[model samples]
Target chain A: MVLKDILSIIFISLGAFFMFIGSLGLIRLPDFYSRAHATGKVDTLAIILVIFGLVIYEGFSVNSAKLIIIITFVALTNPTATNALARAAYRFRLRPWFKKDKSKKIKKKMNWEIEIVLFICLLIAAFVSLYVKNLLTAVITLSVFSFFTALIYIAMGAIDVGFTEAVVGAGVTGVLLIITIYRTSRRSSD
Target chain B: MHMFFIYVSVILSVIIFIPLYRVVTGPTIYDRVLCSGSIATSSMVLILMVGVIFNRIDMFIDIAMAYSCLNFIGVIVFAKYLGTLGSRRKNGT
Candidate 1:
């Protein structure tokens, strides 16, 4: 009996601590996702611990069965509900908050004139690629857009990024595009 | 032992304020929903502690089960309701 009491006390104390921490996280964490992370996962664990501790205290009885049932039900549902709420928030376009460097000043460097010309061309390429009637032309224009993006990276002095963009965007993706385009016979329904 | 349970229940009650604070200040509907979930969980724990304190585990355990049922159903239904909300808004109300 003493052992049982000691065990139950230990379990319940631990559970109360966890519950406090979970609630603290709900308030202290910034933004929706972090708050969700704190409440959803931690709260579930705390409830489980508390209930199981209750069961331990109750011994093998009808009350223990009821306690077990609550634990099972909570364990199953809490995380599921948390995930669903998160998905709904995401679908509703809830923007997550993050810290930004407000004091950081924006500075212009390098040949910005060339950047302006490239940016305009990029916009034009993107537009043309989307609205063009021919599939092949769309693919080709997309490749051109990719090529221009690579040039922008070069202008930004990211040489390694520029190389990656050229290879993946202009080389591999261009080939894959042509292959996918030619592979299909049903060009258009309209 | 009863004193221990009493102290534990008091702490649980105090802990609930943190989640309640989030429910008030949370920007999105889901954040508020999440906070409510957290509070319910803590309440369930508190219910168990109360059961231990009163030495009537049978009666209080049922109440906790009922609270759990309500919490799960409310949250799930709310999530389902909000799922298509974005698409409806995009479709111009």
Candidate 2:
């Protein structure tokens, strides 16, 4: 294969791998705080890598410089935003999830079951989006579908969009939602 | 190379949906504010991306800059409201 093809494949694969890890973090982390940690740090890092791949593919173009600038801003802001959310949560007195010992096996088991169901549902939603319905439906289910479509843009050399997706999807959305959950209910004290 | 631009734009818009979920399901006013900020941040990125996708980064850069300023103002407004609410509740006590 040509060098461009080789690079594209490698970068895409790397991005996918990072995304997978980030998703796993979403599922496996015990609670909102840890989930924020996983989503914000690992996901942000993965997307930066994906954008870097796109930047390389777009080399020497003006778009490439813009891509780099977006990347820099994201790298700077993503973590700060997440930190701000976490601080907000802490200031509001949200508690981290901590399971009691096996002496409370029944309650522990219940929590585990709840977590498993959440994971399964999220997974199913992700899987189904791969072959779902019409464009309108797809638009509705868009977030559930993979970011693989983004690779197409990179292959086409649209670095700016790739950077935007990484920041908005992984960075801001995750932090805002986590903080919102804390701010919204009695659960903020927990 | 052109296809690259398409992919980037698609991805940028695609991810903007995630925050919309928070905006829709928000349990409180502050949540909505936070989600709106996320949306604004994403839109700013989208504006910049649009410029790049269309090969007009200069124009989009201006838009993104303006949007960022607006977003900052919005966040500050919300935060100020939050502060006042907290102080009012305290004063009543």
Candidate 3:
């Protein structure tokens, strides 16, 4: 029994340690694929370890049998599901993050030039949407406009307002407009 | 030993927030979904450890199993939803 206690302790602690590492990687990793890699791979080993420890602690019993089943289920299912999500994300065109040119060492102020340009593009999207003849294009462009507005609020440090704008302005309003267009007509006003 | 379980669970609960930070401010929906899946996975372990502390692991084991199944299904559904949503947007636009 003492041996069982020690073994369970060792296993569960190791499981917890790996779980921490996985979660850390999930947050700190630079890209979606890397984050997925962290969680998908590390958590599987961590869960199996933790559950195996529980199995050892429980000994030969119906509960242990059930735990073994869980281990099997988790082993087979976790990676498959994570892979599915990753593949779907790729299909969705959620672009990967890339580091800026290392050799150039551009000034931070210079970065604002691109930000300003993109901001102007977003502004033009709003105007273009107003004049666009196609309702679908207008709705999509308006969504982009609202999303840019949310980004501006976030930059100004009003996180709550930014989040609200992102949710209500970009997400909810866009969906409603799309639905309205679909149900009524795909035509926009002159 | 019980004290040990308490310590580990406490530490793990704290660790959960790392992924949650990503879920909240993730740049894309994929990041949010990925972090959420991680959080759910960690929660399964947390639930089991809590069960051990309560000396009701048999009950908690069942709960953990259910959580695992739910986690898998939820991610799969999310993938399907995003797949179709993307295609619909493309076809519509």
Instruction: Rank by lDDT, highest first.
Output: 3, 1, 2
> How would you encode candidate 2's per-residue C-alpha lDDT over B1-93 as one tens digit per residue?
455544544554444444434333333334444444444554454454455556666555544544444444434544443454455445773
- DockQ for every model comes to 0.21, 0.09, 0.24
Model 2: number of clashes? 11
Q: Which candidate is the best by TM-score?
A: 3
Q: Which tens-of-lDDT digit does each residue in A1-190 have in candidate 1? A: 4998899888888888888788777766767888787877888888888777778888999989978888888889888889998988888888888895333222222232445555665776688678866554555456556655765664455545755665677556756665664455544621
Which model scores highest in DockQ?
3
> Better model by lDDT, 1 or 2?
1
lDDT of 3 by residue, A1-190 (tens): 4999999989998998899889877766788888888888999999899899989988999989999999999999889988988888777776787984422121111222223533554565568668855554555456556545654453344445755665676556766665565456434331
Model 1 agreement with the true structure over B1-93: per-residue lDDT tens digits:
777776776566556545544544455667766776676566556555656666766766665666566556656655765676666656875
Q: Clashes in model 3: which pairs?
A: none
lDDT of 2 at A150: 29
Worst window of 10 by summed lDDT in candidate 3 chain B: B16-25
Candidate 2: regions farther than 4 A off: A1-32, A61-63, A98-190, B4-8, B26-49, B61-93
- Could you tell me how far off, in angstroms, the CA of residue B10 lies in candidate 3 after the best superposition? 0.6
Chain A TM-score of candidate 2 vs. true chain A: 0.53
